[model samples]
Target: MVGRVLHIFNIFFFLISVFLGSQVQGRSLSVKKPDPDNAAATARWLVAQNSWGVLNTISSDLGGAPFGNVVSFSDGKPGKGKGIPYFYLTTLDPSARYGLKDPRASLTVSEYPLGTCGKIDPENPTCAKLTLTGKFKLVDPKSKEAEFAKTALFSKHSEMKDWPKSHNFQIFKLEIENIFLIDWFGGPKPITSDEYLHPKM
Candidate 1:
């Protein structure tokens, strides 16, 4: 009879522990959610309607920098494919070469609606944007991944198909280590991977 009572108590304690654990997890998710009109959601939304954005790279010394290069981007997913989050670039492009020399780079995408100031200001609610900071590397041309990158790029930027020796194209995968999301007039906040995936916006 003592053994039976002990077993029952063990089962009861296990059930209570699971219930408490689930509650904690739920609270954690809720707390991490950002403002619905902030930077986190903006990153995901940027990829939704457009396949292009500005790729920014800063030298290790932070001496040279440029903005808005009109580069094509992929969500690392092949339309309806898994979301791996990558970008296709050409080594032939001066920007790509700059990036190769300085692997420390960031990609900034806008979330402004059609028209209105794309600039960020406290009053501008439409000025939501996400800047991803990470290390970038050139994709091996002979690899199968390059084949998919080419197909995806050509599909989005048909003009690329007409360029001669486009085989020199390189895929740059920005292994995102951090995301800085900004809202008009709001200080930028560092977001976690979970927050990046489910941004409020």
Candidate 2:
């Protein structure tokens, strides 16, 4: 009788342990796959939503590389097609001038704070931002590319016409190759092109 009782007890404990293990495994899977989150699409979404972003370019001068500057962008207009961004900049614009001199450049658009103003935990920093790495090439102002850029600019910022114009003004299209979205500090595992466009998770 005692042997039978112990056998039943062993089976019950085994089932209970298995149930707990399964729950843990399920939670692990959920964490690995953050819901409704496609990093590439989300990156494009974040950039589309914001009108302004800081652009980083490589300088040809003897000084240094990775020069950062604030710039305005417009996406998806009558002339400018989707999946492309247009910017209006002058030769006086250090980044633009340097980019013209050296076509190799990487643009970073982020939720640049006017000044950090918030109350949050020190260890867990929370912010919504996206960073894009790609090359920037200047386009002729009178060319077909320029027409698209102008239309896109006017659509996004109607007041752009009021600003002083320059012949050196050029449009740069970022050939995005990588995107980084950060919800916390130290950077999350970047969603690659394949994973983002067609997530297997």
Candidate 3:
């Protein structure tokens, strides 16, 4: 009876160890967010890590009201982000149409999707959010930049490559002029387009 009880205790201990190990592994899989004080790094990190965000544009059909649409974007290949958001868009989508009418737009991304914000409400200031406001321009399909953009977009979103070619998906990029970042409790961080695009090494 003594040996049997010891064997049962060992099994229970082994199970607990496996459970704890899995929990640690799960947490490790999440990307580590940058320091809140580093606004440029934080903003770039948000853009690089997130696969999609809400792109807001001035609606041409809605009497010039602001309209936000969920869309997929890529800054660069994984870990090679240039800090500029590139998108695969088609005029069939209202966002592409609105952007063509009025190039002014903003792309907003949240750190919540990265799974680094543990137990924090998405709206909570500490959750970290970034918005890049600027002119939305379409890249000429034949240009070298467009080639890079296509690679960036297709790499991040594989389905984009197999998307219906009839839809005429064109490459678009935001000419970031201003940045709004909220990573901590005080208020939105004051980061300029230049600062974000060219961070100090």
* C-alpha TM-score for every candidate: 0.61, 0.63, 0.84
lDDT (tens digit, per residue) of candidate 1 on 74-149? 6633333222245666666566777788777777765543222335563354466667777777768789877776
Model 3: what TM-score? 0.84
lDDT of 3 by residue, 93-188 (tens): 999999998999999999887677889999999999999999999999999999999998988888899999999999999999999999999999
Model 3 bad stretches (over 4 Å) = 1-31
Q: Against the true structure, whose TM-score is highest?
A: 3
Cα lDDT for residue 19, candidate 2: 71
Q: Give the candidates in order of lDDT, highest first.
A: 3, 2, 1
For every candidate, C-alpha RMSD to the true structure in Å: 15.4, 15.9, 5.7
Q: Which ten residues in a row have the lowest lDDT in candidate 2?
A: 26-35
Ranking by TM-score: 3, 2, 1
**Decoy 1 TM-score against native:** 0.61
Show pairs that collide, candidate 2: none
Candidates' C-alpha lDDT: 0.59, 0.61, 0.88
Which residue pairs overlap in candidate 1's backbone? 76-86
